[model samples]
Structure formats: structure tokens, C-alpha cells
Target: MDLKIFSTLPILLLLYLLDCGSAQSPPPRGCESSLESVYFNLCDLNAVWGVVLEAIAAVGIVITLILIVVLLCIIPFIQDKRKKASVAIQWIFLNSTLGIFGLTFAFIIKFDQRTCPTRLFLWGVLFSISFSCLLAHAWRLQRLVRTGEGPSTCKMIGLVLVLTLVQVIIAVEYLVLTTVRLNNVCSYENKDFVMLLIYVMFLMALTFILSTFTFCGHYRKWKKHGAHIFVTMFFSIAIWVVWIVMFVRGNAELNKSPDWDDPTLSIALVANGWVFILFYILPELRHITCPAKKEDDPPENIASSQRNPGLKGVDNQVFFLEESNRGIALNFEDNLHSPSYRGPSPMGRNVYSSPQEFTIPRPHTRPSYHPTPLLQDPYLNYHNRQTTF
Candidate 1:
């Protein structure tokens, strides 16, 4: 027992010395509680900007998912062929908006070699895609307002892709220039980033200018679409201006510019994503997918117009220019059954309006049927032919 006690004392004393040694050593940086801690950076409670941007990103993602689902649901019920064709452009535009929201998280995270390349590439590319979609839509609206005909679905999508491709090329070129040739993947200044985005800025400017023409065209009905685009571009331009100012010159004045960069970008991305959804996507869907109320329709007739498409109300108006021949659909036969669909029959005397007037009932047809037994008499000659009158 005495020998065992002596041996155990030495082992216990050695363990005590080891613990003291560990206690005297220095601890790691104050990053143990955050995800960025692993990278030796601040996050969560350690960084206010990071926390705020993270929360905004989460909300933006949820809203984006909801908008996507709503847009998908609305696609099938669009009866206008031209409007249905426009759905493809809306899809690309929405996808770009979602990418904008998702990329905000990348900005919120700590910048490093792995993320720097992606940030540089996607920042310009995604913005370009969004702006390009707006530009293509502006072009389509311009054409529709002028000639009452918009281009085909393939053409609109192709235009957006072509415009976006230029920015993709620019992004690739600039990324290689900074990350490879300069060997400064994570060391580029805000000015370098801003300079690379010049092409995207031009797209924004072009879209804004083109949207103004929506009111210049003869078709006043389509002015609403133009107004939606104009408002979206207006707010987007403001966001860009404020961010670009802060990202380039405003931060430098404050001395700790690097700390403000992520916040600026993250806020811009989130605000713009919401703007696109609230201003353009929702209103565009409401107008293009649902029937607009005509001011001329009586309260009683409103329900009837919705129940039947053949009724010659605003729903039956030649509002959408059919893409088949880029002209109005000539089937006025659908309007023949509506009792109140009558208008001054200029075509009764003019041959040019013959197709529209031919369906109007002859002046004497209604008078012949009510008082006379001709409608009920089975032996009446050619009764089947006379009933059609």
C-alpha cells in the first residue's frame, strides 16, 4: 500500500503541471461564437451589418419563392397569345431578381479568395440580366404601341439573352484581368468593381430612356405597361446612384471604407429585389393575366362580361394584337348575340366595314317574329331558314 501511494502521487503531480501549462497559454481571437469566427472574422452579434443583412436575405428569399409560385400559377389562364408569349420574358426577369436576392448572402459573408471571384462575376452579370430584360420589354412595348403588334416569344427571349451575354463577356474579361493578370483576387478596390459594372449601368440608362416612349405611341391602352416599366427603372436608378456614391466616394470620406462595402451592396440588392416584385412583377401579372374593367360597362354587365368571353364588351375588344398576321382578329360574329353591342352602322353604307356590319340584324326581322305565329307554325315554308334571321 505504501509503494502504490508513492507511484500515484508522481502521476497526479505531472497532470497538475500539464494543466497549469495549458492555463498559462494565450487564447484564440474573440471569434469563438460566430460563423465568421472560423475565418477569424466578426459575424452575428459581433457585426451589426452582417446580422441585419442576414435577416433581410432570409426574408427576400421567402418572398422570391412566393412570387415564383404565383407567377407559375398565373401562366396557364392567360388567354391572349401575345401576353402568353411575354410570359417567357417575365420568367427570365424573375429568375434574375431571385439571383439578385440570393447573391446578397454572398456579399454578407466574409470576403475571401473563393468568394471574391464569384462576387465580381455575378454582381455585374446578374444586374445586366435584369436590366436587359427590362430593356427588351421596353422594346416590345415600343413596337406594340406603334404598330399594335409585339414580337414573338422567341424573339423577346433572344433579345434579352443577347443583351445579357455582353455583360457576361464583360464580367469574364474583368474577372480575369483583376484576379489573374493583376494577381489580386481579393485585393481589388471598390473603384475596380464599379468600373467593371459600367456596361450594366448603360443597360439601366437605356431601359429608362426606352420606357418613356410608351406614352408616345397611338395606343393609349398599353400606356399602363409603359408606366410600370418607367416606375421600376426610376426607383432602380435611385438605388444604384445612392449605392454607387457610397461604395466609391462616400466610404472613403469616412476612412473605414471596407467595413461599409458589404452593407451597401447587401442593402442595394435587397431593396431592388423588393422594388422589382412590388412595382413591376405584381402589377404586370395583375394587368396581363386578369381582365381590366371597362369604364363604359354598367355594374350589372360587369359580371356578364367575366362569365362569357363572346359577349361584345371590353373583354371582346381587339386589345391584343394577334401575332399570326400582326392584325386585328376579324371575327365580329362573336359579338352578334349581345343585345347592347350595337353601334352606328357606318358599314351599312360603306363596303370597307362590311365584315363588322353583316352580323347586325336586319331592321324588320325582330318585328316579324313577336306578333305573328310565323315563329311557331310548323308548316311555314322555309321556317328553318327564316328562324336564323
Candidate 2:
């Protein structure tokens, strides 16, 4: 009876294993007929989110191309010293815009052996180039306002290139190692790529710090520039925070279904790219394109002229009348004691005594007037009687 019981235990264990396997059977594979089913399957190109992402990326590419063309066309016409100083920054902006274009492609295209390296490598390098350029601009503004000297264009370009090259090297190593370990195939789990984004975060942090430093003092001379940089960096920080939270924490919690990972990244790339364009690139473009203000007339003079319109009009009329009557010459000796000359006139008591009178040629069409002196005037006899009244 003991031997029979031991034999029966093996049969019982087999039956239990079969029951568990049957209960935990995998679901059916292949596409479902329902519209909701089609939308949820991220791998399907027909997915509504995928279509929206593609449209957003296409629009970004179009806008970026238009900006690039506009920038190139206006290069020769940008004459403002500040705008000229930002030439390198504008070039980097174009490159960064293109990089964003490439990044969007990575999301639009299905993740595969062909696109993984493009996505991983370009992401860090491009963002580094852009933010480093911004840092250089902030540094230039700080130096100009604080020290009254800005870095040369070559130095600015070199700084950006050097900083960007470091990111390039990092991205290259990351890609090479990742690919080699994956046996030359580009397959990678999303978690593995998260580590590579650390380099981009460092660049963003550095840019934010530089922008913060730009606002340290009054910086009255660079107030506008500082304000733009501060606002841009603030927005960038907020964007990065939200995206990082969504990608790292939010995605994990929501990964039970077909992964929304690609869409999250796509949204981040599109949203951040637009933010940079609107806040940073658009403002710089506007500065370059807008006409420079004339400094010949001081603001005080302008404000005074605006405040005293009647005085300004009278002064202008007097100046033009004097100019138009330049050909007429008149003696002023007889008018010295006239009633119109009560005390001294505000127009200048000795207006006729100016040396400019010697240079004025008597016009042939006009006759010169020479009045007798007040001592010889017939009105002199009546002057005491007229004043007595």
C-alpha cells in the first residue's frame, strides 16, 4: 500500500502541472478586427497616435527648413553688432533644428537595426551643440556687459564645437558598445538607452546655470538678452522635467499594454523642438531681422520734443523762415529802441551781429535795406513822447 501511494504521488504532480499550464495559456496572436484594437497596437502604422506623430514631425521639418532658408537669405543684411555676434549661434540653431528633424524621424520610423544608432547618437550630439551654443551666447553677453568686451566669433564657435565634440565622442562610444554587445544588430531595450540621455541632461544643466549667471547683476546693458535667455532656459528645464518623468516613471507604470514608449519620446522631441524654436530661435531671428534703433537722437531729446509740441513747431518754423530769408539783408540799428524790443527778446538780442552775416551774398533779385541809425532817426524826437504814454 505504501509503494502504491508513492507511485500515485508522481501522477498527481503531473496532473497539477498540466492544470496550471492550461489555466495560464497565452492569448491569441495577430490583428484584431475592432477599431479600438487597431488603435492600441503600436506596431501597426495605422495606429492613430502614430499618424499624429508623423504629421507633427512633418510640420516641424517644414518649419525648420523655412527658418533655415530665411536665416541664410538674411546673413548678408544683418549689420547690428549684437546680431553679427550671434552668427555662430544661428548656424548651430540650424544644425540643432536639423538634429531635431532627425530625432523625429527616429520616432516616426519603426525602431529597428537601421534607426537605433541614428536615434541614440544624434540625440545627445545635436542637443549638446544647441545648448552649448546658447551657453556661449550667454557668456558673450555677460562679458560684454560686465567687462565691456565680448569674445571673438572664432572663439565662440570653437567653444561650441569643443563642447559638442565631447558629446559626440560619448554618443559614439555608447553606440559602438551597444551595437557590439548586441552582435551588430541595433536592438536595444528602452531602459538601456536611458543611460545615454544623462549626457544630454548634463548639457541642459550647464546651459541653465549659464543662463542663471547672466541675471546675477543689474545688467542694464544686457537686460533684454538676459531676460530672453532666462525665459528660454526656464522653459527648457520644465520641458525636460516633464518628459523625463513621463519616460522613466510614467512609462513604467503604463507599460502593461502595447508600449507607449515611442510615442512618449516622439512627443518629447516634437514639444521640446517647438519650445526651442519659439523661445530661443524665434527671438534671436526677430532681433536680427528687426531694424536697429537710431542712437543719434537721445531719448531725452525725443521725449522733450514730444512733450512741447507747440514750442517744437514754432522753433522749426523760425529755423525755416530764417533759412528762406537768407538773401535779405536789413540794418537793425534803427530797431534797437523800437517798442517791439522791450528789454531783450528771447530769440537773441544780438541776432543780427552774428559772423554768419559776412558769408551771406546779397541775392541779385532782392534789394538790401539800410535803415538810418536811431540817433539820426526822425522817430527819435517822438520816442520820449511815445514812451511817456
Highest lDDT among the candidates is held by which one? 1
Winning candidate number (TM-score) = 1
User: What C-alpha lDDT does candidate 1 achieve relative to the native structure?
Assistant: 0.75
Q: Residue by residue across 1-389, what tens digits does model 1's lDDT show?
A: 99999989999999999999876543343445323422332244556666666677778778878877888898878866656777888888888888998888778777877778889999888889888888888888888776667888789888888988998898877777766777887777888889989989999999999999988865566788889999999999999999999999998898868888888888999899889988998889888876534643432354455567576754433332122112112223333344644443442344235545433221233444553212332212323433444
Candidate 2 lDDT by residue in tens digits, 129-194: 878888888888776555445788989899988988898888888777766786764666666677
* Collision count for each candidate, in order: 0, 0
Off by over 4 Å in 2: 1-46, 184-187, 216-221, 256-258, 291-389
Compute the lDDT of residue 261 as modeled in candidate 2: 71
TM-score of 2: 0.62
Residue 149 of model 2: what lDDT?
53
Error of 1 at 75 (Å): 1.5
